[model samples]
Target: MSTLTTANPAYKLELTSSPHIHSRWSTKQAMWMVVYALIPAVIAAIVFFGFYQLIIISMSVCVCVLTESAIKYFRGREISIMDGSGIITGLLLGLILPPNFSLFGTALGSVVAIALGKEIFGGLGFNIFNPALVGRAFLQATYPVPMTTWSEPSYAVDSVSSATPLSAMKFDAVFAGKTEMLLGNIGGSLGETSSLAILIGGIFLIAIQVVNWRIPVAMTLSVIVFGGIFWLIDPAVYPDPIFHILSGGFLMGALFMATDWVTSPLNSKGMWIYGTAISLVIVIIRLFGGLPEGVMYAILFMNGFVPLINKYSVPRIFGEAK
Candidate 1:
């Protein structure tokens, strides 16, 4: 038998396991990049809401970090708070909450986000649902009245009882102008109100290749196509597709929540399926369901199917026998 060796005695082929391909990208680096991307939304939230909203964001982040540290310490794991995942979870949860949501409530949600949403599932890479959305859902279910309470932009005066665009449309038969929705002058969640801010952050993430472009594109196209169908059928009854894109949590969830590295599918085809299904559910719920918004529910619902999607959607190896 011929022995495999290099011409140079020191040079020899090394045997390694799979994943022969590697990138310089680290989980810490990616997590911090996501933090940077969320800055615009944070700034926008401060502008649209009041300076007090900063307290909510700060408290949430602190709580999340502390909760994660505690859990990791109890489990005898190395502290990983500096990795930035906890901050991202806190920031996302704060952004989705109603303006001026109680600090205690925000803290409670933060603990659940870290303890139940993440650590309970074996931490960061193993989480099945976006931790932030989990926190939001918990808040929504536990405190429906406070969670649904909306506030007008800080600039608005003499506006009584601010209602989200979706809620206004669904309950009062009132439609907010597209300009108001686009500019985020209308009432909604802290970060979700400003489609402009979200687009700025989301596009930056895609540009840096930190976020997969397929998920957001698939979601946007799906919403446009499905939502457009209903609008075309009865323009007078349904708001235009642009309205759906600009209002509620669709943009935020599609770009940030649904695109979570752990919870989302592993392949391009699976991404399309995941994004489309979430959008379809959102349209159905927004148009016909009791709740005015469904982005959180839709994304979480699809997250459960990501494993199956990945299992079946895996690409065939080149030249492999079929």
Candidate 2:
């Protein structure tokens, strides 16, 4: 029999998956890191929307925490609210909502996010779609009027209530200037208001390796290329590529939502494919479809194919003879 260890043994062969050297990281660590990275976007939302926006965020978070805690208590599992996943879901959901959304509605969305999007699907790692987005989609379906009724950004309060850039482009051929969209001075969802802030958060996440950079880069480039083609062909109707990239939830969706580890693909190749497909779907819906924006739908639709993407993209065994 061959000996597996030496006399001075400081190492051992552990049978596991590809990542044999397990780091000291845990789900809690990754979850909290993501929460910390979102601070910049949260601050920007508050600044743009005011103290009232804070209340909406607080309510959503509180309700989400409570909902998850209750589920765990009933399921005989240790309550893991401190894990930060539920908090991230709540914050993301709240950030995507209109700032003036009613408190009760926001709370309801939080409950759905935790219960349906997460717990019903066997909780965090098992969920197939991004939980926050699932909740947002439910809200959109149930409350279309409220979901579409956006409030103006703080800087433009003196101006009349306005449609979002995508909506304007779709309905009136009106183009929102790039500067306001970059600085987040125009009307949209709480988080989508500021491209600058979302970029800051995205950079932090990428720097810390909290998210894979490939998905965002791929998605962004696809949108630019696709949108640019349409714009060059018919500038009279289609807005420029920069507008599509900066407006609405494109940055937030590409960076934070679409990159959810549980929902997105596993391999680099699959990630590029997923990102490119998502961007194409978004442009198709925004340009030709009835809806003005499509990030949420695009992400959720692609999420369904993640399993197939992973299956086909798996690496072949090394040094194997066929």
Candidate 3:
């Protein structure tokens, strides 16, 4: 017979690594800060795509948060829907999607992002891939035709073509001006169209140290080197390096998705390698492969190598001998 004792649980000490200084910041703070940074791009999306875009964005966000919460509930774990990471992931996934993408597909992608991409790996810090990109990859595989379909922005006239700049280059042998691409008067994904908006937001994040600057810089440099080489080889056969850098999802991938804290490599050297490798893959895929745009695939491919890069590029211990 066991006696029932009304005793409270004993307190236990938790042990961890060094550098115990606790900052005022937290995961929620960082996530929300990123959300704030992405606001300009969201605004740009609405301006260019119209109100329906907001509906898609809202649907994605709600579904993502709900899916995360449901998974936690089923597993009997603490709910983390309020943390803002899901919102950011959903927003990013939606931003990269075409404005006219089916809402059901968008919601399904959000669920996959939260369930398989994040929760299956035990949530935020432990995930191997960027959740947004994971959702996008799934969507691209399942709905290739819809994913590739392009629509004109609201500011364009009825005569304007519905093809994205990259698509125009790939199929129609035409190129949009730098001015249209930069200002986002051209057709593309919701958030990726406006270089000006993405730059404003991305620069803000880098300025505040929310995002590492080395990744974007290295990627941009590699694009310049490889793309310039191709352009110089035959200007008539290839678009200019400047055009490659500005068009498609390159800026959005470099600034936001590729720099994801959970997926990107740690330390400056590893980040440089990661960024450069991703850029090279993008250039190769766009220039030599069947795809017109390759940012999504390139980032996902490099994400698999982050662990190896981190292993090799670990920073030297302070005061350690050669």
Q: What lDDT would each prediction earn against the true structure? A: 0.88, 0.86, 0.87
Poorest 10 consecutive residues of model 1 by lDDT? 1-10
Q: Pick the candidate with the highest lDDT.
A: 1
Candidate 3 local lDDT, 1-322, one digit each (tens): 0111112236244353432434345556767878998898899899988989989888999999999889988988777766788999999999999878999999989999999899999876778999999998999999999988887898666424789998888887798889888988888999999999999999988887778899999999999999999999988878898998899999999999999877998778999999999999998998888989999999999999999998999778999998
Winner on TM-score (2 vs 3): 3
Tens-digit lDDT string for candidate 2 (1-322): 0121112334455233442323244567877888887788888888887778888888998999999999988998777788788999999999999878999899989999999999998777779989999999999998999999987766555532468888888888888888888988777898887899999988888887778899999998999999999999999999888888898899999999999978999888999999999999999999999899999999999999999998988767799766
* Candidate 1 per-residue C-alpha lDDT over 142-208 given as tens digits, one digit per residue, 9 for 90 to 100: 9999999887888666442499999988998778887777777878999999898999999988888
Alpha-carbon TM-score of each model against the true structure: 0.92, 0.91, 0.92
Native-vs-model 2 lDDT? 0.86
**Descending-lDDT candidate ranking:** 1, 3, 2
Which residue pairs come into collision in candidate 3? none
In model 3, the Cα lDDT at residue 33 comes to 79
